[model samples]
Target: MTAITEALRRLPKVELHCHVEGTMRPSTVVELASKNEIELPTSDPTQLYRYTSLDTFLEIFWLVQSVLGDGDDWARLAYESAVDGAEHGLVYRESFFTPARHLDAGQDLGDIVAGLAEGCVAAEEATGVRIMLIADIDRAYGPGPGLEMVQRLVELRRANAPGTDRVLGIGLDSTELGVDPTDFAPAFELAGRSGLRRTSHQGEVTPPTTIRAGVDVLGCERIDHGLSLLDDPELTQRFVDERIPLTVCPNSNIRIANAYPRLELHPYARMRELGLLATLNTDDPALTDLDLTYEYRSVMDAFGYTWDDMVTIALDGVEGSWLDPTDAGALRARITADADQLASSLATG
Candidate 1:
């Protein structure tokens, strides 16, 4: 690794778009598959991640999700995911866990949340990296199930069930094509009423109108993968004026969605230039063979961003996070202090 890349690796970073299941190690997948009695088409770790499109990627993502047969499996997955991210300088994260399939398979939501909480707490103690959960609604399952999931989540919170406290918000992901964001509005609304923060994956393959629906109809506090927002100048300006956060996963767009043929062609720089609150993240890090540090280095190299530019992006991550004022101030201070030290070391070295 280059000095810059190495330093970037050690720089404290926050991730908001990561999926916990997507962080499962390849070897862990093999073990989990065996434990769950699920058959794999291939045991080769390298070959496992090769995919041509988003749908193909989801097939693999779902396969990974299927491996968690119980709470213990989930705890293991969460623990390893957080630990791996911590190694890459992830100091704080709001990780997504979509349990629709697991729920449909007769697993209790409480068990899943409790298991994830147990694992994340362990990881926090070990790495000093804090993580909170966002329960995502799988759009492929349709609106009814989505609402049901949120209702159950509300019930868990009402009962003060284990791990519900760790779940700070709700989000909608998976299969955006041909699905209306408003269909899940009831779920998002209920979550809002229950004091859950909200966000949704929009514009990855859809248009700006869907992105608008995500914000207006669903009342999402943030938008994930709002790649198509620039397609509508008016909407883009609104996002800029409002400083709405877009959790952008540039490499994932290239590798999974095929939205752009290369990283250099991505609209990330354009988004920033327009003064939109676009934060860098790795949507499915392990699946795409990505980490936040490499993400920083690649964006810097691709867009000719200097260390200061990268630091700005890192700070934007803090601003875009779901952290409250006091906690956010503390995290921003930490990143600033660490960045100052790292920059001094780099200058000297």
Candidate 2:
């Protein structure tokens, strides 16, 4: 209902599992591409994000990264993106940042995180939006580099400048093909030892077993793209029982089309019916030509979710994210109060 749309606007949101570079607006991409002296495939930002398959989408995603050539580019995008996120009512966000995915093919990992952290700091100052980074490894690269990336992220978090939430966790991103998350169990063991939280992408383009492997093996506190969990009722029931959060990305799922395809086909409703912990997000906002609002709105429009259901789902994100408990509680309280007041106001009218 239109009331739900207006109500959703009033309720602040917490984003978990968004891709860093994927948050870069197309206009930002164009500007960065020009400064880096790179030729882009399209002048329009919207069209650039219109890729239909995972393969083509990644090609465009990597090409955008190529246009962002240095630490400054990285910082600029991250900071401004924080501003964009804030304008979209984001109080806190957990970003899955993959430094190696765009590491200039031979750059040091330290340099990558350095620029990103600085940008996160600057973004916080500029917008008051708390941004946390999750250093992610491309699973497509096999277990070797994935472990290396996780180790470096742990070191970076340990070596933080203090007073900020710098790096919060480790994530397994990129295309999960023949790569089963269980294969990298040792890497997660190392990440866990360093006090970094963990999560991974699975069951999006694959099967339900991948979701099980991600949970049972990689030791993920939360599961990303767990759309396949529905295929296995046992897993769905377990997820609902265990209350493990699933970060659902409606627009990105539709864009990738390799996963859940259309927004109507997205399983947020069914997951909700089962009482599973389902959190909505835009996996790649820029690549999907979406923001958190668009993703939530699209899901609401397609699934006919009410404002109350949407608010409840938003709260699920706080529980499932890597945010500190105190912060999570505060955010949940605030959003819950706001939602209640908004609904009450409408009811009275």
Query: Could you give candidate 2's per-residue lDDT for residues 1-349 as a string of tens digits?
Result: 4665666655789998788888888898889888978898888766777676888888877777777677788788788878888877787888877766565377666666667778989989887888888878777677888788777666656677342257777888777667767878988989988888888888888899999988888888898888788999998899989889998886777777566547677777888888988888888876776777777777877888787778877888888887768888898999899889988977875
Tens-digit lDDT string for candidate 1 (1-349): 8889988998899999999999989889989899899898898877777789999999999998998999999999999999999898999999999999999999999999999999999999999999999999999999999999999999999999999999999999999899988989889999999999999999999999999999999999899999999999999999999999999999999999999999999999999999999999999999999988889999999999999898888899999999999999999999999999999999999
Checking candidate 1 for backbone clashes, the offending pairs are none
Lowest summed lDDT window (length 10), candidate 1: 43-52
Q: Please report the candidate that would top TM-score against the real structure.
A: 1
For candidate 2, the lDDT comes to 0.79
Q: Looking at model 2, report the run of 10 residues with the lowest lDDT sum.
A: 156-165
**Top-lDDT candidate index:** 1
The lDDT per prediction is 0.94, 0.79
Clashes of 1: 0
